[model samples]
Target: MDHVNISVANNEEKGANVDFDYSQRAQWLRAAVLGANDGLVSVASLMMGVGAVKQDVKAMFLIGFAGLVAGACSMAIGEFVSVYSQLDIEVAQMKRDHITNHDQELAEKENLPSPFQAALASALAFSLGAIVPLLAAMFIDSYKVRLAVILAAVSIALVVFGAVGAVLGGSSRVKSCVRVLVGGWLAMAITFGLTKLIGSSGLQM
Candidate 1:
C-alpha cells in the first residue's frame, strides 16, 4: 500500500508541467529564412550588376523580374524535394521501428513532418523578399536613385530578416542582423564591381 502511494505521488509530480518544443518550428523557420535571404541577395545582386553595366530602366527591371520568378520557383522546388526526402526517410524509420520493436510510445512521440507546409513557406518567403528590390527599382525613374534605393532597401531587409531569424531560432539578434547585412553588402559589392569592370573592358552584353 505504501509503495503504491509513493508511485502515485511520483506520477503526479511528473505530470505537473509540460515542455513545448519549438525545434520543429525552428526547422521550417530556417527554411523560410534561407529562401528569403537568397531571394533578397540574389535579385539585389543581379540588379546591381545590370545597373552597373547599363543604366537602362527597362533592362534593369526585366532582369530583376526574371530573377525573382526564377528564384521563387527554384526555392519552392528545392525545398519540396529536400524536405520530402527527409520526410520519406523519417516515415521509413518510423515504420521500421514499429515493425521491429513494436514501439507505440515512440511512434506517438514522433511528430509527423510537413514537407508541403515547409515548401510553401519557403516559396512565399522568397517571393515576398524579392518584391523589395523590385519595388525599389520600379517606382524610381532615375538610374542612380534606383540603384541607391535598392541597396538601401536590401540593407534594411537583411537586418530585418536577420532579426526575425534570430528571434525564431532563439539566438543573438544584433549578431544575426549584422551578419546578414554585411553578407548582403558584400554580395552586392562583388556583383557590381565585376559587372562594372567587364562593361568597362568593352564587353557587350
Candidate 2:
C-alpha cells in the first residue's frame, strides 16, 4: 500500500512538471510567433511597396535588407525594455510580499522573465521571418515573378506561423490562419497600392 501511494505521488509530481514545462514552451511559442509575424509582414510589405515603384532587383534587396535590420533591432530593444519593466514590477511585488526565504527568492528569480533572453529571442525570430521574402526575390530576375514569389512565400509563412501559434495557444487553427493570412495580404496590398499610386502621381523617388 505504501509503495503504491509513493508511486502515485511520483506520477502526480511528474505530471505537474510536464504541465509547467508545457506552459513555458507555450509562452515562448507565442512570443516567437508574434515577433515573426510582425517581421514577415513589415518586411514583405516594405518590399512590395518598393517593387510597385521600382523593378530594380537591387532596389528591392536594399529595402528588404534595411527592413530586416531595422525591424530586428527595434524588436530587440522593445522586448528588452518591456520585459525589464515587468521584471522590476514583479521584484518589487515580491519584496512587498516579504518573501524572505532565500531558496524561495532564488526560485522566484529563476522563474522571472529574463530581459536578455527575451531580446535575443525577439530579434532572432524577426530575422528568421524577414528572410523568407528576401530569399524569394533573391535569384528571380523577372520583376513580375519576383513580386509573385515574394507574395507567395510570405503567405505560406504567415499561414505556418498562424497554425503553430494556434496549436500552441489552443485556439482555432482555421481562424488563426485566416486572420493572419488576411492581415498579411491587406498590409502588402495597401502598401503596394498606395506606393504605386503615389509613384504615379508625379512623386519622385
Q: Model 1, 177: alpha-carbon shift in Å?
A: 0.4
Lowest lDDT 10-residue stretch of candidate 2 = 22-31
lDDT by residue (74-165, candidate 2, tens digit) is 99999899889999999999999999899999999988988888888889999999999999998999999999999999999999999988
* Candidate 1 per-residue lDDT over residues 26-89, each given as its tens digit: 6688888998999999999999999999898889889989999999888888888887898889
Point out where model 1 deviates above 4 Å. 1-19, 99-110
For model 2, the local distance difference test gives 0.92
Relative to the true structure, how large is the alpha-carbon lDDT of every model? 0.86, 0.92
Task: State in Å the error of residue 18, model 1.
Answer: 9.3
Clashes by residue pair, model 1: none
Off by over 4 Å in 2: 1-22
Q: TM-score for every candidate vs. truth?
A: 0.85, 0.90
